[model samples]
Target: MDFWEADELAAHRATARAWAEANIEPHWAEEQHRTGCHQTMELHARLARDGILAAGWPAEYGGSDVDPAFAQAIFDECAERDLHVDGWTTTSMVLHTIAHTGTEAQKHEYIPAALRGEILIALGYSEPDSGSDAAAAKTTAVRDGDTWVINGQKMFTSTAQVCSHIFVLTRTNPDVPKHKGLSLFLVPTSAPGYDLQPIHTLGGQVTNATFFTDVRVPGSALIGEPDGGWNVMRVALIYERGVSSPSRIEKTLAEDLASWAREARRPDGTTVLDDPLVAERIGRIAVDEEVGRLLGRWTNWQAAKGGIPGVEGSMRKLFFTEAEQRHFSDALDILGAEGLLAPEAPGAPAGGAFEHGFRAAVVTTVYGGTSEILRDIIAQRHLGLPRNRPGG
Candidate 1:
């Protein structure tokens, strides 16, 4: 009826708490606010050394080399502290692809450095014209003797200004179907003709609009087989979602909401905790948050056993994102006018978390994949429904 961790894992979470108090807490949020990024390499290396950064990966590939639960316990430590790094959550996706599908030299070139925090790569999948329909990418990769010349523009690149490389998806063959013609490449940020401009987000952070003009990387930059990039995206997104999460972000956020409300007082000076309606809402959030963890745990167990589970990623992402939006919106309603105050405003409730989270929730529904798209995925792939309907 309930989920509880083993005593050892609880102790591991406690160690993570101490680690945060000593290293991450003092500098992390200020750095993120200052540069629109939270990319402290020293801190990143610390996480990697402490076996937190690797999450659930195996030892030979530079992972913390622990089982998924231990890795997740560490991740929770970071989330509770509000600690973050721009690309740390995603770097392993790139590493896993390299370790599995890359040539021996490519594996040697990327994986170790990535694990050591010397190299970081952003997911260069979304484009200017593309949001959910990722298969329609128009960026092209042309072979020039031993080099592949890349020309394309990408949007929603969260860590472009700070990362060392981008794992780009490009069209290598235009004549084939849109999905089959794509390829992925690991193009270093140092390559000439690469440009990035900032895109400010409602969440008070910066992502980027990145352009590649005649950016050249050797044939060795390719990951997996040519025309097989779609599969690479498929693999990467499973990790990007909560299946391999270090700290279970959505669950933590939901928990924080309940904690904030307990201390929040209505204009009548009674704590929100004393109000039955607020109690009901908080109880609903707790239920949904628990459901999300159950979904993630089931799928994460599958990932630990060496497979992506059956559509659990879609289910988890869909429920948590939608719930995140609702949780903040409901908090705003519960907090009355004080909830609308800006973060750090003198009268703001819970340090204006509701206003900030309300804005952040807008992007949650769109990123990774939209709720509409995930619904279709569940309907078709998970439920075995017809893909195309004739005048539904």
Candidate 2:
């Protein structure tokens, strides 16, 4: 299929741009740097009012499904304005997962709330030991009459402190293979025995370490069939990795660095752009950005065509994240000491944003899926390479 958008989708892009320019631009810096849960909730509420959040859900559910590109367009538009929606990314992932797999009652109850920025779901898949290997989750859930008792910890669960629900991946049948024995549940964050501790990261976002101590929930809380969460969780992963909610912030990030090179002075009173290596670094990042963008658009196209983006998802995540790290690091190198300044630091280049970006980019490699794991997946699935199991 052609990657180019039709006239209608292009109009959605214009609408997204107009909305971001009007509503998000004036507070762009604050919007980008706000780290509080309350701040994020308010941001999404504004996005919902602007009709930007959850555009893929049905209109009856307070969502607009007119265009598959609508959501990604929002990402791109906000990025241009330097608005940060880091929390929105995973929340959108969880929403999409629910859209695909939830029961009618679950859909009616949760989807509309999410559209209005009312509730958020924290993904409880990875543990201290099971980071990339989510299937090795040791979080146990045992059925007792009509309730399921859960006990264990989840690492890197973002927004759990603010979320009303924690969609947990638990082991319900240890007798079966690790993947086969898994189950999914939408455990309330206020459940009697649940706990959340904020873990501050270099990225400036606070993900959580959630603990479940005999947390009990009704059978209705189960997302899919018991011991059949491998499939359900896989769908969530696809959304996490494949869904490209455009944070086009990086697009201008690279462009701004290139623009700065002309004005930036070297120690000897020469323009930084005069350095061949500096020019080359910016050139390389520009190319990487283009490639990452095309790959994302291609994957988005595949999803719109009603196919699960398997290898293509891995491809986009791998290239885009690695490219992100490269962009930040290169910008830092080019900016030198000025790049190390904080956003509030006086005379800080790019308001020291690339320095902040450089630190955050380290985790991007590990988020969604690790670069190493994604490479292995692409090799096995796309390159038809022999799969090598770790610790097999």
Candidate 3:
């Protein structure tokens, strides 16, 4: 592992930092943290207009096609600034999958719009019945004359509320096995018979439950072969779980917690940062943050070298998310009763960021994949362990 940075990446980092400083409004962070409202289309248009949205994508698809390290730098910088780039990350992951596995027509139809941030897509993988057991999806799509009619429900769709399209996985052939019968479709959210309802969580963010009542799409909507969606989705999930780095929330929380620790005063006239135990906790968190950053950078490097991010992605996600949860849990302990104060309360530390973070951290362990499921993948796929039998 080379602990070195390339000159081009360094330049991109400088450019991204400058752009963010100038364009990322000061109020945007507070607004997003308080309301969980990310600048989706506006941010996309800005990034695209500035030629920074899909930096690693090929120039043919309206991307700069720069080094993959530049992509990592872009994400790192965004995280540093507390910018929510989940939508952009999701778009890039799907677009890259299409570029790799999609038909030329599919590429031509979706890539440009995706790069421009004009077309928003939501991931329709998790189901009400299948949370960690993503392969257990029961949504069905039956082929008709020139269209596929989909009927099922997807839960925990993060941006289904605003997204124009959904990349869904459905059982194309129920007679086949669980993973084999699956296929992926790019269904329009505005299509007739589709309904989306927001599921409010303790976390500030609003995920959705999307129901499809005979939603129909043309044959062209199919990303790959019929009943081969599992394969396509597997690739996409790998990219989803692996390629993207740690959540920016983690970094923002870390920085905020560090700042709070330095000055947070107890009723006993003792500042938290001065206490040895508190200092050690802060040190530990900082160390974990560094480790997460390094692991993410390595994953990016491997991808740039044409390597698949297999266990590395799982490792990063698992470690970073757990670290994030720990960071907030520590913050709550440090704040004691005051930590319970909501963001709206007066004199709340950093506007009750820790309180909000604690709630949001709960979903991190569940989303993408639960820690339990991720451990299973690491064991079965990465460690070559035997798959666990039921109740084993």
lDDT by candidate, in order shown: 0.76, 0.78, 0.78
In angstroms, the error of model 1 at 226 is: 1.6
Model 3 bad stretches (over 4 Å): 4-14, 65-77, 246-255, 390-392
Ranking the candidates on lDDT from highest down gives: 2, 3, 1
User: Per-residue lDDT tens digits of candidate 2, residues 142-188?
Assistant: 99999999999999887777778888999999998788999999898
* lDDT, candidate 1, 1-392, per-residue tens: 13575443665666556766776757676676656684667778786676666555555656666555565666666666555665876677677666656887888778877877778998899998987888888889998999899998999887878899999999999998887888999989999999999999988778999999999999999997888888877777766664645555344545666687677666799887788888888888878878877777667667666776547888888888898888888888877777899876897866676798799789877888889988887999888998765532
Task: Name the lDDT value of residue 356 in candidate 3.
Answer: 82
Look at candidate 3 and tell me the lDDT of residue 237: 76
Q: What is the C-alpha RMSD of each candidate to the true structure, in Å?
A: 2.8, 2.7, 2.6
Candidate 1 off by > 4 Å? 1-8, 49-51, 54-59, 63-71, 242-244, 249-264, 267-269, 388-392
lDDT of 3 by residue, 1-392 (tens): 77554443566668667777776667666666665644455555776776666666677776765554555566566667666766666667788788778999899889988877778788899998886767788999999999999999999887777787899989899886788888889988889999988787778887789999999999999998998887797778778778765332236555677788778787788888788887788778878887887777777668777677877888888988898889889889877888999888998887777898799888887888778878988998888998887633
Q: Which one wins by lDDT: 1 or 3? A: 3
